[model samples]
Target: MKEGNVISERFLLNNERALRLFNGYAKDLPIIDYHNHLPPQEIAENKQFVNLTEIWLKGDHYKWRGMRTLGVDENLITGTASDKEKFMAWAEVVPSTIRNPLFHWTHMELKNPFGVNSFLNKDSAMSVYKHCNELLSQDEFSTQGLLNHYKVKMVGTTDDPCDDLKWHQQLLDSSFTAKVKPSFRPDKALMIEKTQQFKQYVQALSEVSGIQIKDIESLVAALKSRVEFFAAHGCSISDHGLAALPYSYVLTDAEKREFESFLKTDGSVYSNPDAFAGYILTELSKLYHEKGWVQQFHLGAIRNNNLGMFAKLGADAGYDSIGDYKHAERMSAFFGNLSLTDQLTKTIIYNLNPADNEVFAAMTGNFADGRMKGKMQFGSGWWFLDQKDGIEKQLNTLSNLGMVSNFVGMLTDSRSFLSYSRHEYFRRILCNLFGTEMENGQLPDDEEWMGKIISDICYYNAEAYFNLK
Candidate 1:
């Protein structure tokens, strides 16, 4: 186990007769990360990490969910437990997660950063913990170091209209090699039911744009101004998260007028959530068209309903679950509504449930005019499926039903820095799948052809699809 030893002959290019054919391309390539939740300010400032647990475990709901699944107490998770204690608790749960993607990602981080090969557990936790903490103190493991380690070329971070964009400005002004761009995510502003927060957001947007938003038209104007501000800072994409695609049977002008009236009277119009959400989506799409930006929709997440826990720990603390939405038909209607007008921008649809893989993969092709299969993309397997099995299934489904060659590759979809190991994990599984297919005579053995496929999935597809420089 040597430092910076990411690929191994035994595993990456395993000599096992069945897996050898997979090792055809470079292990490291420039990453065009089109989507993620990383704070733009941290990247802009080139922040230094403090410890292994703080960087890896804090604010990571995936690990938090796993810990809860193992029955580890909340104190060990989000409570006041010391970092070392939490690491020990996580180590105890590791062996049980043998076949889990966490097992692989944890070891990959350890091997790549600290050069430790020993399995992490009660016995080895202290040494591995201390070693990683020490390395993190050095210049090589800083935020920029991690991005360089993975060769990330560009990243689009989720941001709200209220954000000052100071951090984004910092990135543009910095000398760092990786490009950090802002992406407008206006979910909170649109979730008008959250009255206080929504009003605050409106005030912030009005202040930022210096335009008072008194009505729907003025609100739209303020948002457009913010989008232009974001674009000036290299934003070319906007993201929305919803439990399901909005299909409200086409609101009539009178109905839209009433909705606007409701907003003025009550400071909100979400009393009929579906219709309001649908109207907002349509308006947002129009904005996207005017700006010539990509629009991303991450659908099918069931969020917090556990009142007690939510009040205590706040949102995204492991209470969120997948939804059982009627995804295909609703998605069709949603797209159908967009198809009526040619205002649809380059779009990417991401689903949380794997059961919808065939549905989503099949859905993308119906919208693709064959002029470009990549234009309407089934986004990378997100949140719940941001793992090895999830990524492999997505690739296979896209390859079989749609054009895998045109698919954009991996995205962090994470709030943690160490989660970049996910890209490495995705690449390994991708290579193995292609290699196994080539070995089985299901695909060509030509390295040139295989390498092109590998590079497309790794970097080129995202670069070409997003028009990233």
Candidate 2:
């Protein structure tokens, strides 16, 4: 393989059939990134990055964490360092990230958009930076241009209920080809443990929804109003990030009263955090079902572990890690309750901890709706589990427990425009997995038939699942 072709044309494809499936079925398929953290405003404005660091290093906690691991100075990582200096610091850590996904991601990103086939390292940092910076200065390197270059058909950006979605509206009127929509993410609304923060969030929610949130009923009403508002703005999906699925079907009336009391006071402690979260999430899920929206739960992440670094850098600063939690019961209770009521809409569950793979996969089977093709989806490998082994494990598990043919495929779940290479990464892995099966005769030695399945998992399934025609 060439220097920058580290993830070559046949990087993960091991056989001739694998290569054929990748090139013929998956390579040029349009991307519909159904969930991600990319900023809608950047796409609306078509913002041009000034340098390599600004585009690649900024807000990328994956690189920041790697830099910190190398004992790189805080100043160079996220402090008041020059952009070039930060790029150099990142390049210094690139070679050290040999077995890490960042290593593959870095070179693939360079090779695709910027056409830099040289490997990135401290020795080659200056030339790579200068070359990439020149490319960044081009109009084709702007935000919208990058999305277009990657053949992105649609992107669903994570957004708060309090947002006006003005950027999404702006994109609607613009000539941008790809559809940019919002996914309602009201995680903070469920955080009653953070009293002041919750209060402030509720107040903002009230202001936006034009409804006073004095109690649980009013709070739900306000959230419902926002849901309707979001629906008007072309949002048909809701996302939640939680350490575990919170569920409590037997909370005492006194506990509910305590929640009401806590809401009215600036109390130092809220003892009913679990019940409150469960109650609010249930109500929200009902609203999601009513709206015919897909509800996504991203579970098992213990976030902001290092308080000192958290205080210094804040949330999503690379301090989060996989968490262990008993998920089966709560997941069953939550979905089973909705299922019983005939209120379970299309749903996708993403597990951060790979240990819960079987649990999540089996649980999706328990609530499968016969009406919808892939209603209960065990989503693609996410966060800490989006790499080769993770992807293969998820696919194998889903295939064992359910129909792999109906599986909705890869999502960037990323915060960068250049991360579209991840889709390429995922496609190559998918083709390799199926094609290798064909080679071994475990599956039929058929290209066209298997190619359809590969293309479906890569693109067609998601298009149908999300109703993104």
Candidate 3:
């Protein structure tokens, strides 16, 4: 019925300097999506989507959360609804997402690559659906093609310690342009709280590593072996998802024997689970340092709040929320353990709670050895905080408390191929922030210096941080 492009060329940048920096430098930089849930299979096989909804709506918890907020039915949001019906349901919700970053992100995704700049409302649903579906059928819209179009230089997919990385291996062997590598995520290995899952996971680990995990000692050996295996396949990153950093409480010899006994058998957990977690994490961090891997820790998520939904749909299906965890002391202790031993590697810490922005930022400064360019990074806003207000707050806080110029920039953390436009969304906001400060005379009017700063934050910093050529 009507047509418009909400995310214009100068949409986010409020000042002339911001606009010039974004256009001249940040826009064309190669994307190093250092952390995401993008399926390696999709990239290796170059999977083609049958329709727009398959790529846009299918399995995107971000959109699901929005639609469910407005009382959209489960069937329409994630159930067995027709593709057109789900697109229309999302169309109904898109216009209502005003002031939400999703509104800008959705429109930007539509505008770029797909060439559909009109607002995605109920009226334009059919037209936009047809246009996007047509493009999805082409070779250019397949997984690899989308990576090529976006200039994605490297992608680090979150992976378990036991993962065979068959898809990653396939990509490495193929003539594919993108460097698809795996980042070791050993969250489950550290999850000693879940008895059943932990036991079954140990079995899987034994199967993969051929090392029968009889106790905590064996578990460490198995994980170390996997780290070597991953490094062989070009893994330069490792990630941990913890509620907060675990501390090392001193243990007596008797208690230590008890803990080891429990580890080999199904009994009450170690008396000092926190200390155990800290010890294992420290050991792993040492290995990471030895291998020169960048270690990432995502903290402060109080997940599965909605028990009914959690039981029905499981985790990361939009049931997680921010937690108010007191992380500074334990975080410091954890880092202190590594740094004191001279075993601290390049580390990025992502806090989900915006309230803890300054806390996390300040923590990064505590361990800056000047050895690594940005030795300790306050990571980009993630999960619950991956929005405009949150992104700006994190950036501003990092600038105030640490070196924002050395920041590694944004990531999708998304399960969708259409989410690369988020990089554009972030770069614009970044330039706007820098340019606004210049306009207010808070910073010197230096476009060349400012442009270089913006460009490095967007691309060069990430390339150097991740050691990507």
Candidate 4:
């Protein structure tokens, strides 16, 4: 087999300025990964993988989706197949993922920590697997070691409201270098339509907070207690996953009473699930404002479409897709209400659909109070859009509609430690964009000014935005 690097040092650095900016400014900057699904227990325990599959393939829905696309069998993909078998199956599909970002990401990850530069395919599977597995056994490849290897200063793991956060506390107590802060993810709290899940969540929240959640008032009180509990644990960020921002008025006394009755006995879902969510979210945002936390909304995901597969594998198992939802009016109303009462806090909004890029970016400008730099953020391209085209469109849209300079940049939003390679991917693309513009004489050719802006978007802005410094 021919042997060579899959990606060179200048892979995405399209111009001299792009190369200069990436190497000098963006490459070595410490990462502030403010949002991800990294398991706190794995980080706290310093778990080491037995093989490449354990760390790389396990829980990686992106790869799983790609494998499924080429008609890979269920057993090899996610079933009772041996670890080696699944890794081999994924290797078989890598070459076929030519235009996909997974193709770039797979090669980038292989090159970075494992140093296996040759392209991964059926022919090279065993060799690549053995090489990476050998490296995974090292201390530097351990979970904490990987974070340190990438110079991750802080990681905000998505956590539920009812989460005990014992693992987070363990990280805080340990001699671990990176700050593993929890970001309060109360998505299930807004999912009242999932009757069984909602009830269980309320029970769990009550158990942890010692608050009896009998109605909307009690539920709000319970949520508030959890918010304070999370803040005590060094968490100053909150996240929500929604289809779209739902516009609704604050519940009246009569409506609150009606919701209380509905909570006592499940009946017809209390008029509108969205309205209940909006009311609760409004109340929660007020608490977020009071606590000075940054709130994030990842909107427009239509999840669990494949019910048969959903039953077999569950959510986040490569079954979700981008949702088409109108945003402008509802968002304006939602933020408008928060602004009216001075209850608005620093917020980041992520859109899954590329069509909503301009809408999401413009919405951020509507609520910027001038009290803080980039107080309202158009978040990084996320979920289905976490790739080259998505990132470019998001950046271009933000530049056209708002200030891209103050943008708090990229995040992993991934379950794998190897996903840190995405930061390099984003930085190279970012530098390329700016470099191309400079080469065209669209912007002034001052290295210092452009370099500082690059560094800020890559690291410093997020540092100040999340108060991580």
Candidate 5:
């Protein structure tokens, strides 16, 4: 029943209490976003967003999935609903999403960006919405302005080979405050079973690289050229999203030739999807090692099997679900295959299934040489695991099995701008974990040491791991 105050002293914490201890460690640390899917062109142009809804709610499948779960229609999610209406819908559902990471992230965004101290519900939605929309129109809320406000030092954007790198070039040419680098993601190109799209992509890549793609050899050459092009533009990493680790037995030249011949047929090669994907991943890993680039494998996501929804809305419209793949032992074989030949570059493995966190986390350490304690990383909690519970589990698993002090930190892994609040969410959960541990005497109660650990997880590790300046 009390009126909400925008900036109450009650919310302020001086450097004297447990909350103070956490905030002191958290505040002002630079963000090193090692992997994300932000549109580089937006960053290159320093684009100003139209409103909070446009920036935050539009392209985020996480929120969209929640909205659908709450019975909001797809029209509102990906179709024409005014920003105000969509935000109101989000507000209505926000309270019900308690115990979900979205609740924390939503409040954090509101509190940090607009200084709103109240919860988002039907009653307070309009007030909070109007306040954020107004702030978004200000010069201080531009993309560059927001990154600067967050103290982000660098961000790695997922880019395809067919990209022209014009936006990356623009960032390099201009004096941007934050460094924006590209991460080559060749999934769409490598998954050649999607024939029509694959052929179109080949033509696009060929045109971009000025190479004629008549056979598998030329296709590999074209891909190689694009990789060099990406590296020249400051890309130091390559990312692949797969359902599981690539563990196909080494293929013979005869087998590869037969596969290529199949591709030249009806343009549909779904007969042996795994063999083709495995072959491409091996070749891609070879390329990664040749260039000394860190390779990221995001495995265990099962995507878009709902034909009706897929036909109506297309891919990534929130139809994807998690897979129950037997990941651990197979993944060991995959990484072992790469390790035996000493062809493994610095690798980061992100598992979608939390059940395998311990397995994956422990498995990653086995591949790490003592020379670099954290060279091969167990990536942050991803997809469904991006929330508080998920992040905590991952951090704990890594802390128990590996070194949390050497973590690569939080990545948006997002398609929307408002998702930056994910970093703050991760920082808060991280601090809370350390604070509780320190309070319970599980860890030593030393602020300076804890501060350094917090900084390392939030920023430093990614910088050192990626060799980002």
Candidate 6:
């Protein structure tokens, strides 16, 4: 294959039939970025990027982590380095990320939107930089324009309970045809460990909800008000990022009051933080179900490992890692409670620890009640697992444990405008997975039937599962 065609026509697929299905059906299907970190304000304002580095490297901890591994200076990586200098530094590091997924992603991104077929590196850096920068300067290369160019049908951006979602409202009214919506993310509200931050967050919630949060019940009421506020704006999803699913039994009011009294005398420590988190999560799920929303749990993340770097750069700056958290029992208890109460909304569970793949896959089946097509989803490969091998493994595991046809697949889960092509990358992998099965006689070599399955996995399943009409 030619260097320019790094992601060639038959890139990941093993056969022509699968390749045809991908290119014809799945490739052009509109993207539903059901979960992501893309700023809604950028889309609302239709902001134009000054240059490639500002857009590509900014707030992208994935690339930042790789550059840091190469000993790239903080100045170039995230500090006060000039745009050209940072681009040059990134170009130098590009060739070094050969076997890494960043290598493929970088080249593919360069091909699309930028329309640059030439490779990206120190040698071609200046030319590629100048060329892409010129393109980005145009009105068609603005933030909304980039999203539009990728044919994004809808995007569900992660949002905090405290956010007003004014940008989402603006995008709804803007000339942009694509739907921009918010996904309620209440991670901080449930995190009661940080007394100071939690107090401040509660105060903010009180101001928003006009509820005096003197106790756990009042806090839940404040959160419920925010949920109502979010629902009014057409939010249909709630996302949680938790290290582990908390399952400790919540204390009764008497027990909680006694602990609160004891804490006053002890000067530190309160009632069980685990019970607090579990109670809040359960209450939130009930609200989610009542609102007819999908609840997503992103589990097993060990965040902010390096305190020094976390202090310097703050959270989500490549300081997190995959965590080994016991999930099965707590997950069962939590989700089971929802089901028993008939408050189990459509759910998606994403496990960061790949070791728990089978556990999660099988668990999804345990909750599969014949009520909905895919009421419980083992979510697509996410964040750290959004690459070739990871993608394949997830597909295989889901296929083995559940109906792969019912699987909703491939979210950008990214913070970059240019990351939409991840959907294409995933489509190629999906086709390859099915194609390999066909070639091995595990699945029938029925082109049209196979094509429909791949198409659904790539686009329609998510559309239907999320009710994104």
Candidates sorted by lDDT, best first: 4, 2, 3, 6, 5, 1
Summing lDDT over every window of 10 consecutive residues in candidate 4, give the lowest-scoring window.
Answer: 262-271
**Global lDDT of each model?**
0.79, 0.89, 0.88, 0.91, 0.80, 0.87
lDDT of 5 by residue, 267-315 (tens): 4555556666676677778889899899998988899878898888888
Model 4 Cα lDDT, one tens digit per residue, 352-417 = 999999889999998888788999999999977889999999999999999999999999999999
Which is the leading candidate under lDDT? 4
Listed per model in order, the count of residue pairs whose N, CA or C atoms clash below 3 Å is: 1, 0, 0, 0, 0, 0
TM-score versus the correct structure, for each prediction = 0.93, 0.97, 0.97, 0.98, 0.92, 0.96
Off by over 4 Å in 6: 1-3, 255-268
lDDT of 2 at 212: 83
Off by over 4 Å in 3: 1-3, 249-252, 263-268
Using TM-score as the measure, which candidate wins?
4
Q: 40-125, model 2: which lDDT tens digit per residue?
A: 99999999999999889898888888889989999998899999888998898899898998888888889888887778887888
Root-mean-square deviation of every model? 2.5, 1.6, 1.5, 1.3, 2.8, 2.0
- TM-score attained by model 3: 0.97
- lDDT by residue for model 3 (329-412), tens: 988888987877798999999999888999999999989886667899999999878877888999999999998889999998
Error of 1 at 145 (Å): 1.7
Tell how far residue 9 is off in model 3, in angstroms. Answer: 1.1
Q: What lDDT is obtained when candidate 4 is compared to the true structure? A: 0.91
Model 3 lDDT-worst window of ten: 247-256
Question: lDDT score of model 3?
Answer: 0.88
What tens digits encode model 6's per-residue C-alpha lDDT throughout 92-143?
8898999899998998898887877666889899988888899999988998
Q: Among all windows of ten consecutive residues in candidate 6, which has the lowest summed lDDT?
A: 259-268
